[model samples]
Target: MEAVTKYSETELVLLLKQRQQSAFSYLYDNYSGALHAVILNIILDTELASDVLQDVFVKIWRQINSYDDTKGRLYTWMLNIARNASIDTIRSKNFQNNKQNRELTENVYESAGSTQLMTDKIGLRKLVHQLKEEHKVLIELSYFQGFTQDEISKMLNLPLGTVKTRLRTALIQLR
Candidate 1:
């Protein structure tokens, strides 16, 4: 194998679509650090960041064909995957237990942002944070963690009727 020179993100993505090892190597070498930074900034744990980085790359490799240049750049797509994975990992039961063990409880409601976690996310993080505790929790479970209403009800130990009522009330307040 010869040392490869520079290639634009588009060109590398094109090669990646063809499943070229060199292209994969180039993409990882060039963008891994940026993506890691994005994940680390959101998750703020070195070990977790590394794990999510690996997951992000695996997703990118598997879903490369889904990339569409007309929509956006390759890095943009990869960034979205990294952000979602980081948020997902943080929401996992493992993360919750780990937080309890470490005495460092994380609030899923508090991890919103404009760059790494949720850039331009409904333009409502700051506003949502100002909401009542019940509202904040409902929004976090439903929007941030991607949970359905029933799941949120079970997680919160609340009745399904209560969850629906709170979510509806929260939306009205937000509006």
Candidate 2:
């Protein structure tokens, strides 16, 4: 039987930052399952979830330098990456278009009542569409697409304070 290796979080972080393959392997062996579970909850498709899991590990390996122990645990940082990756996958243009195509096909075969139910499930998205254009864009990017405020600011070429203020106003209107 192969023996397992244990590492303190600090030791693991140090080794990972140093680009040690053994440390990465150990990290993956210990945390992949939990990280996969987190991705699965967001993605729901097993195959896609597995792909996202692999991407998450690669991201963790590459982004280890950005992980701040003073801010949070290593696992928590990794969890956030897994979650964001899953959400980003689902929000991709290809994914959205594919989902729409699938829904259209399903709706054609589904009963009228079921079609209405599916439409109702999009209530929040529909409401966001009703918001003013600026607020709507901010809400969709930050909430529906899981982008951070700073990311949205850079993408929209807007100031960070403007993004936050608009997001706050949008939430208030949503209430």
Candidate 3:
């Protein structure tokens, strides 16, 4: 932690570009939690957030030299990487299903423990809860569950275009 405070962000980035261990250690120690917060805010799943954080760091390691300091701050670069990686993870097939299973297990556990206490607590959940049943179902299966549009269509017994349209609408609503 002391070492992290030793260098400015630009200096740390320069060391990282040179593949310095101390720099990497300092970046991870100082910035990983902040990066993780951004990733988890978008992903909203612990396991997916963990995977995205790993991938984000790996990307930063690989692309260190490609970074142009003129474009933005080092923190911005890292934040962008984390966001892109988490979005990619969300778009992946495995993540969709895994996300769904995780959600279901959590919901079941929550309901079992205290149903009334968990009713649409967060802003996102509250907004999602306000959606029509079909839109809500599609959003759940596609985004949170990590199902593809085709998979969601098949699961819901709806046309492919319908699923796509609903998903688009749901995402627009979320935004």
RMSD of each: 7.8, 9.0, 7.2
Instruction: Tell me the whole-model lDDT of each prediction, alpha carbons only.
Output: 0.74, 0.75, 0.71
Q: How accurate is candidate 1 locally (lDDT)?
A: 0.74
lDDT (Cα, 0-100) at 30 in candidate 2: 88
> If scored against the real structure, what TM-score would every candidate get?
0.56, 0.56, 0.55
Write candidate 3's Cα lDDT for 1-175 as tens digits: 4662588877988899889998888889889998887676446668978888988988999999989999999888888788667657755644456577556434433432342234355444456667877787666555444457886676668899988887788878878
Candidate 3 accuracy as TM-score: 0.55
RMSD of 2: 9.0
Residues 118-157, model 1: lDDT tens digits:
4333244545666788887787667555678997787778
List, residue by residue over 1-175, the lDDT tens digit for candidate 2.
1338788999999999999999999998889988876665445468998999999999999999999999999998998898789877866734556567445333322322333343333445446656887897777566545768998788778999999999999989988
Give residue 7's lDDT in candidate 2 (0 to 100).
89
Which structure among the candidates has the greatest lDDT? Answer: 2
Give candidate 2 regions above 4 Å deviation. 1-3, 93-95, 98-175
